[model samples]
Every structure is written in C-alpha cells, then in structure tokens.
Target: MTKLSPETILQHACIGVMGLDNNGIIQYINPRAQELLVCDTHNGISLDTIAPQIWKQVKTLIQQGMNEQAIHIQGPRGGIEMVVSPVDKKAKTSSDNFNGVVCFLRSHEKFESSAWQYPTIKEMHLQFQSLLDHSYYGIYIIDGNGIVLRVNDVAAGLIGMTKEEMVGMPIGELAEKGIVDQALSPAILKSKKPLTRPLYVVKSNKYIMASGMPIFDKKGDIRFVVVIEHDMTIVKELRDQLKHARQVADTIKNELSDRNLLELKSHEVIADSPAMNQLLTVLLKLAKMDASNILITGESGTGKGFLSKFVHQNGSRKDKPFISINCAALPDMLLEAELFGYEKGAFTGASNTGKAGLFELANNGTIFLDEIGDMPFPIQAKLLKCLDDGEIRRLGGTKSIKVDCIVIAATNHNLEKQVQQKKFRQDLYFRLNIFPVHIPPLRERREDILKICDFYLKRYNKAYNQKKRFSEKCIEQLQGYHFPGNVRELKNIIKNAVVIKENNVLDTVLPPGKNKAVPISPPCEETAAPPASKGLNEEILAFEREKLTQALNHCTSTRILADYLGVSQSTVVRKLKRHGLSVE
Candidate 1:
C-alpha cells in the first residue's frame, strides 16, 4: 500500500466531508464536499449560510449530541443528503465534551443505494444520556408519535418530573395530567413548522419561553420535534417592577396636580429663542405632571444642573429635599458609599454610626446625578438595580432599604458613543433617559445672547450699585464671539464688564491670559484697514491667529475649538501648526 496523506485522501474521497466548529461556523470543507455543495469556496463561512434548512436540524442534533443520522434534502442544484455527527473531545461521549461536528455529504441517489447501518438501541440510549449536560436551557425531543424520546434534566425539572419519568411519556399526557399548562410539541406537530410561545408550568409555577422546531423526514413528514425553553422568571419580575414604577409615577403626578404650583420666573429658564421656548414648554409639562426620570445633556456650563433643579423645584417634589451629587467628583468606593450609604464598619476609617446615603436622604424627592457618564462601571449596576427595584442596599448591609426618588442624571459626554465603546452601560442609559432634555450651546442660539446679556448686565449693575452699561462695540463683540462656556461664560463676561472697569461705557473686556483688556470686533464688524507695511496675506494670517488664540481660552481641545470656529478638525490643526499655535 502506498502512503497517503490526509489531504490527498480527502481529495480522492468519493463522499463529501465538512467540519464545523461548535458555533456551526465552517472550519474546513474538502474539495469533494465543495463540489457536492456546489460551492468552490466554502471555508470560514457559517453552515447556515450554505444550507439554512439543513443547518437548523444539524444544530439541534449537535445541541442534543445525537447519533449520526442521514438527513435527505433538496438543494438549489438537486437532491442532496447530509449525515451529521458530533465530535467529542473527551474520552467520555457527552454533550459537554462535544466541541465540534463532522458532516458527511452525498447525493440522494447514492445515499438511497448505500447500505449505511443505523445506530442500535444501546448506542442511541448512550447518545441520549448526554442531554443532562445542558444546564442553561430546557431541551426536549419528542418523536413523530408525540412520545418523548429524550428529556434533559432542566426540562424534566421544569415539568416537575424526573428525566426517566418524562421519557416515553406522551406529551399530550403531560398537559392532561396538569404537569404543564400546555405542550408545544402538539402545536409544532400540527403546524409542522417552528413556533414559540410562553409555557406556564403549574407544577413549578414558572414561565418558560418555549421554542419548538420540527425535523422532517425525506417524505416531508415530521420526524421529530425539538423544544428549547428559556426561563422567563426574571423577565416577569422586571415587568412587574416596571408596572410598579409606573404606578408610583402616576401617584406622584396626581399629588403634584392636586397642589398649587409656584409661578416660575422668566429669568430662571431664559428662552428668548424658539428652541429654548420649545424646550421650556416641554420641561414645564414634565415638571408639572410627568414623574418620569429625566436626562439633561449638554456641554459643560450649559446649565444642565440648573435645569435639573428647575425640574425638581417646580415638580411634585418641590416641598421635598433636592439632593445633588457629582458622580465623577468622588473616588469609586466613596461614590458608591455616598450614593447608597454605608454600614458603620463597612470599610476602614468608617463612620462610627452608619450613615444615610443621598438616595435615603432624598426619599420622596429628586436626586441629581451630575456627570453620570463618568460613573464607575461597577456602580452603574447598583444604580440600575435601584431604579428598577425602587430600593437600595447599603455597603456591607444585610437588608435592602426602600428608597423612592426620581433620578435625574446629567452628562456632557456623548453617552451613545461611550455605549458603543463599552464604557457606559446601555441599560442604565435607557433607564435615566426616560425624559430626555438637551440644552443647546449658547452659540447655537445667537438671539438669546443679547437677552441673557441684558438680564445679567442689569442684575450685576444693581448688585454692584453701578449704572454702567455695555457700549455699542461691546454688545457687537459679545454677540460675535463663540460662547464655548455657554450662558455661564456670557453672564460672567457681562458681570466683569460692569464691576471691574471704571469706564461707564465698557468698550472691551479683559481677554484670557492678559492683564490688559483687548478690543474684540464681531465677525460681522467691517474689517479695519491693515497697516500699509503689512501685505494682505500677512494681515489675514495675523487675524486668523488672533481668533484662534481667543477661542483657545474657552476650549480645551482642538475638536471643540473646531466646532466653535466652524471648520474641520484637520483644518484647525493645520492652521494652528501654520501659526505656531497648539491647544495647550
């Protein structure tokens, strides 16, 4: 006999051979298999992509760790036959040790002529014994006669019976005996197709999401039905919790409606622009009737914290405490302890007496979580639990304390992007984002600039006992500059202009990093004639550097400065480099 390599033997083999990993992803397909499958290149592709109909049955068999069985099918090319067998890695033939599968493919004509031996009764029983290894989902295999051929431990327990008791019993008997609320096998056999429904077992008092798939014989008659069930106990609990939360919200809204609400001042919400006016209208309604959680997002200094308090002070919790905490201010341990409270001996240097957390103190009120995007990952889970269960447990505490408070979280960071990057939890984001409010940056609403300036200017003048006012040039400069710090920065500019300068008509404010004030013309201001000594290009370059330098004061990064300058980040970088300037 001549020495034959495995590759050479595979190439010369009469039947097709294909290998698939546990996930049903094609690991390798011999040339013969590719020819039969009508695919020249089939490696590294999913088995489902090649043969969706056959893939489902093959998957079920792999999950069941059944014996090799020939599956006849009709493909696009012609009649085909596939025999799937699970490959066990360990010496013990069990599903837990099965890592992959080896498939044998052939034409239906050849398969019918061949005398392939079927698995014996002992071999079938040994293969069925591996069903107990699957712990995640309940699995059941009922034959065409509706008699249970195999039952995993999980499925047996779900029906309040032993595996041996469940095996050989007709599925219809389980329903008649009141072992299960209903059986999926009966419907699957009738439909001869896959179906999923919630199965309620009266014996265990558990709800299971049952999905049954039927396997058909060559004659198109149903051969077996595989039922896979997932436990829905947690889902049911979550739904109940959500219902309770809604009820609590309704109670709070009713309470607020019954009481007299305070009239809000116009200056408190500054909405001269249509965008602000629209946002304020929504906020007012949310504060009055809706008790849902709120999420306020904006750049830093855009008054997210102020809006959060505005909602609290104007809502049903107006008479109650309004506690606020910066999530990013404290270390991880301290933040958790502060938010959820801690036992006296929870950690080293602990308080002699156990402390009440912000959540406990803010009961029946609102707790504002600022910079929520910066919250630690481990703490996010606890926060989610509190929002869901309406309770919180102190560190090192045995019992969970009841705390009911509307959580309003604020973040300047792009939470969606952070979620994609796995830095923020998607569930927590969705929970706090029940009622979203975004405060547009001040530069976006230029009309509001003068209104805000007039309001703050008069207030600052009264506070300082001065009647100073902004000159025409000063007003123009304020409107033209990009307010990177939003309303907060604009207010400070007006205040500084009123209090610091001796001139009654302030023409210029002191620029950042300069002791002396610098005159800043608005973008719309007519260009001043350049000195005769300077060329046009030189003058334009100089003007660009000056604007870039001033914008850099309010911005910490090139990305922000680019947005303010209305230019691409690359353009900003190139300009900065040309002018010998950087963000720092």
Candidate 2:
C-alpha cells in the first residue's frame, strides 16, 4: 500500500488543519488553514509567523505534554474551536524518530455524533451569526482593552452605525457622546457585576436603560463585557404625569384648610341701635388710623370681639393677616411663647425648625387682643414695651424684630376702674386708649329689636330655603321684654324661634307666660295714704324680694330670670348674691 504524503492528507481534510512541534513552531499547514487565517500558502508558513502573540502562549502549554485542549478563538468570520491532541503513540514514536514531537490537529466546529447535534462546522457558525443578527435586545461584546470585539445588528442600529464600522472602535467613543458612560462603565468595572442604569443614546437622542454584565471564563478571569439596552421614554412620561397629579392634590388641600380656618375664627354679632351704630363708626374710623391703638368697652354679650374684626378689615392693612389672641385662653407661659416665638430647642416639644408667633405672622397687619383685661400683670410690662418701641424679641432669641401693625384691645371690664383698683397697668391702659369705643346694651336700643329680629329671620330663611316671617304680636312681645344678655341674647332668641317656627309666622311667646295687660289700680285712692301703718320702704323691699324668689323659681337660667324681671343679667346676679342665693 502506498502511504499518502502530509501535504496530500491535509489538502483532503474537510476542516482547517495544521501540524505543530512541541515548541509550537508550525511544522506544516493545510490549504483550509491558510484560507481561514487569510494568509498565503507558502513554504515555512509557521503559526508563530501568522499569529505571533497566540503562538508564544501556546508553546509553553505544549511543552508539558498535556495536549493543550480545545480553545475557542473569535475571528472576523465567526468563532472556531481549535483542538490539539497527541498523535497515536506509534505514530508519535515514529515521527519523533524521523522529525520531532508530533501533534494531531482537529477543528472542534464539526462532529458526526447525535450527541454533538449541529455538528457541521458551517452549521455552528451560521447558528451563532443568526443569534447575533436577529436578537431583540442590543448586544455588545467588549474586550479587556475596552475595544469592541463584535456588535450585533441591534447594537449597531442603536448608535446609528453599521456593524463593520462599530467593530474595533473604543468603547469610550460612545461615552464621549454622553451615551452611557457615567453610570454604566464605572458600575461594571468597579463592582465587576451586572448593573442597570439610565442612559441617553446619542444617535437617536432618545433615553434608554442599559444593563451590563462582566463575562468570566472557566478560570474566573474576566474575558469580555456584554451590554443590553432598553428604551425608557414612555416610563419617564408616566412619572411626570404622576408628579403633576400630586402637586394639584396638594394645592387643593391647602385651599380647603385655609377656608376652614377662616370659618372657625369668624363670630357673629347683632346690632341695630344708633348707639351701636355710633360705636361701629368710631371703630371703623380708628381702624383707618394706621398707628392708633384702639380700646373697645362693652358687656360680655355686647359684641366687643365682633367689632374688632370690623376694625381689622376696614383698616389700611386689610390685605394683610388679622391675628387674634384671647388673653384668658392660655396659661401664662404658653401665652408668652404664642405671642413671642421661641428659638429651636428652646423648650421641650418645640419644633425643630422653630415657629413664627402670631405677632410675627401679623406683621404689617393687625393683632386683636380680646379679653385684654385678663392678661397677666407680669406680661403687661413687656407688652407695654412692645407697644412703645414697636418691636418684640422672641422668648429665647436675642434679636429684636421691628413690626408695623395696629393693636386693637377689647374687653367688657371698665379699664379705668381696673387701673384704679390695681388690677390693670395704668401705663398700658393709657397707651391702648388712643380711641375708646363703647357699645351700648340692647335694652337701651328698643326700637332696633324688631329690625334686628327681622334681619336674622330673613337670613335663616334663606339659609334653610324656607319662607318664614315674624308675627306682629311676637315682635311686640320681644320688644316689650328687657334683654340683659344684650345683642347676643337677642340673636339667640331669634335663632331659636326661627328653628321652631316652621310655619310662615313666628308666634312663640316667652317662657314665663304669655303677655297679659295689667289692670290699673282703681283710680289711685286719695284715702290710701291713711292706711300707712307700716313703713313704705320696708313694704317695697319685701315686695322686691318676693318677686325675685318667684322669678328664680320660674326661670331656668339667670339670663331668663333677668328677662322676666325686666332687668339686666348683672343686676339679677348682684341681687341674687346679695340675697345669699347661688346663681349657678
């Protein structure tokens, strides 16, 4: 049998083949090997001469006789696995006797067994190319030197470039265009793990989310990086819509809270008489004075506080805040802190950001101090200083802040009498008394009762959507009675009558009894003076005490007792206390 030559055997092989010595010198190469390497088939065409760098590394492994196994090499066309194995022992011995160490080379891209399906070298190459070209996601394979080894169609289209142009380019070029640098590169390199981040694609000027992972070989060495990009424009738009919705909701919430606060602070006051009109006029005038400190005096129910709001709104500072503080509402320490702000951490439970006091919030506005006579004596001096200097220092802060505001003080007590009795500071009263407006009791304004009652009736009728009116008889009865609780009592009476009187006319009478005409004593007796055995003063006093007892028994409240007796509530209280009776 004739033996074929090495050159003839290699030329007939179906895959690329080459023969190498133990030192990795290319002893022989076949036609297929030359075609795959893109090199010429010339004499002395050694592996080192064709691929100098890879040959040097393979030489060291070959010397150990371990048969450097199948290794994948990425090339321009596709990937190829090169398997190096020792020749048959007899062949190796014979070859050593003739030439040098011998090795048989086989291309791992092809195999015949079912276990190795997709066996043909051509089939494997086509399969890998199909995956790269048809993938849905953008895929990029970058080497350790930061040069792109291969980019799929998806990745090439992402940067508006062809696959051939993208290959061999530095990854930094994409970064320079502000495409995926800041978050992508550092995360993959530093953490050496998979990472996802938002990125802008320069070619399309679109937003995308990029995820990258480091690829490791069997030896755990980082070989390449694989990056995938997904577009994110729709997601960003949805987020913006959600943020706008939240802002609109917050604005509505704030508006509703402000309206509720306004309603809670407002109070109703009844007025009709000329005396009350005169007082209101004076208050309006005082409110116009930008620098005046007005004082209001009246009984508890005579609407002193309601007039204060009138003063604030009619003033030049109407557009600014109108802050009110009830002097009797809080304890001394709290009142101080509420009127004068405190520094952060000044006291336990204080806000971390510090709070603005009412006075600070009321700058360029008005501050209504209701029940001013009840303010503590110790704080009066500080208040007086604030009025005099037009400045206030916070409870814990060192700096003094100047303020421009109007101060309106209202109380039922006679401040002059309180000053003389040492219950109020004389200097503070003088400072606050730039203008004094005194409102009269409701009884003194008898003509205005029916008018005020009709006003309330109409208001309630409109509110309830009912058409109700007051009867002449009921109006007469109300006018005839003396209201000791003043206008406040009159409003309450009308409100109660309108609520119970569902019909067109309100004819409900007073609680004591229906109105009845008193019979005049038979024309004064000229002879009656003759029967005055007992003193007239004693008889009159006895008759007053008897009436008081009867009225108290018939009334449910001191206010009602005063109404029945045709006297003031204070007058009833004084008489009850004088008679050793507990009004409560």
In terms of lDDT, which candidate is strongest? 1
Q: Which ten-residue region of model 2 has the weakest summed lDDT? A: 517-526
Alpha-carbon runs more than 4 Å astray in model 2:
1-272, 509-584
lDDT of 1 by residue, 283-400 (tens): 7789877475799988766788888888887788889989998786556998999999999999998897989999999999989998898899999999999999999999989899
Tell me the lDDT of candidate 2.
0.69
- In terms of TM-score, the best-performing candidate is 1
Clash number for each model? 0, 0
Deviation of model 2 at 26, angstroms: 99
- Model 1 residue 350 distance off true place after TM-score fit, in angstroms: 1.1
All candidates: TM-score: 0.44, 0.42
Evaluate all candidate structures by whole-model CA lDDT and list the values in order. Answer: 0.80, 0.69
